[model samples]
Target: MKAPQGVTLVDHPLVQHKLTRLRDRNTSTKTFRELVREIATLLCYEVTRDLALTQREVETPLEVTTAPEIAGKKLVFASILRAGEGMLEGMLNLVPSARVAHVGLYRDPQTRAAVEYYFKVSESLAERQVIVIDPMLATGVSARAALERLKEAGARDLRFVCILAAPEGIEALRGDHPDVPIWCAGIDRGLDDHGYIVPGLGDAGDRLYGTR
Candidate 1:
């Protein structure tokens, strides 16, 4: 399927391999959690590929030279609660100095609407780039709500990253926030009746924590 205009599919071989294992029903919680982290790290590399850089003078063993370094304020990772938290560690492993924001939102089983219970973020969100992380984008309700809240909180440059996504979810997000880019390991077929991505790695929050 053709990805939306602002969507980026990270189809790296390693990422695809890990995602396959992650989708296995027999995979244990421990292994599932590890794969999520590994994939998050790989996706992070793609999402931040265009981050601004500046030249800085550095002294090497042989001589002094100019080197490129990340410029401007540190980036922020906004995890959309429980499932999003599963991707946090791997993202942090890549950008240890990056700031973190948590937007606690849960989907109502019956309505599939998003309910926000918590929100906390670093200062000067407008001055930094924010990447919202969530493992699955099945309905896109929670993601859209989280992004809306972040925008109201002063986040200007924003992006969304996920391990898997549905076409419906991608379209919904782009329709609401066309300027914000999306990066994911893969885009699944579509959502099922209960608002779950078909053949999705089954409830990510459950598998990650052994809650199910």
Candidate 2:
């Protein structure tokens, strides 16, 4: 019914429709990629609703008018490595000028924990609102690790966006970063034994890249 604290389930009709295709086991790679991108754009709209705006006078052929524009520093779309990149194209479509950062963390099979290998972020993260994205929030190991890295790099304002999430993952993230909000198309049953989201679309990176 309701998502837990600091979690937002994006229930937009179009978002839900795309999410259905994403959850289909038989969905093709090309289609899955498209759906992920589309859903990211839709989620972006909702997560950015409260972004500060400033009014500026605009000149028109008929008359001058005031228009609202995004205020302050441009946003940073910090992608959590491979799968996170899948959601980038669509987010960029909405914020064409937003800077991008890539945070790479691979899961240790035995430990089932995140291990960072690469991290690169834009400067002045404290001044910008960073939106970290991944197709799914499964174990939240990567999401948690990614946000920790971003914060270390000075990202004070941040948001996490995903297509699907597990309740365990949401709680894990909330437990660590209570102030950072999360937005996802839906939350599935839960994480499976190996830390994968049950009924999830299965390894988003693989599906997006047709790797497995």
lDDT of 2 by residue, 5-89 (tens): 8888999899998998888999999999999999999999999999999999999999999999999989999999899889999
Cα shift from native, residue 19, model 2 (Å): 0.6
Candidate 1 regions exceeding 4 Å error are: none
Compare the candidates by lDDT and give the number of the best one. 1
lDDT of each: 0.95, 0.92
TM-score, cand. 2 vs. native: 0.98
The candidate 1 region of ten consecutive residues with least summed lDDT is: 1-10
What is the C-alpha lDDT profile of model 1 across 1-212, one tens digit per residue? 56778999998899999999999999999999999999999999999999999999999999999999999999999999989999999999999999999999999998889999999999999999999999998889999999999999999999999999999999999999998899998898988888899878899999999998
RMSD of candidate 1 to the true fold?
Answer: 0.7
Instruction: Tell me the lDDT of model 1 at 169.
Output: 94
Q: Candidate 1, after superposition: displacement of residue 20 in Å?
A: 0.4
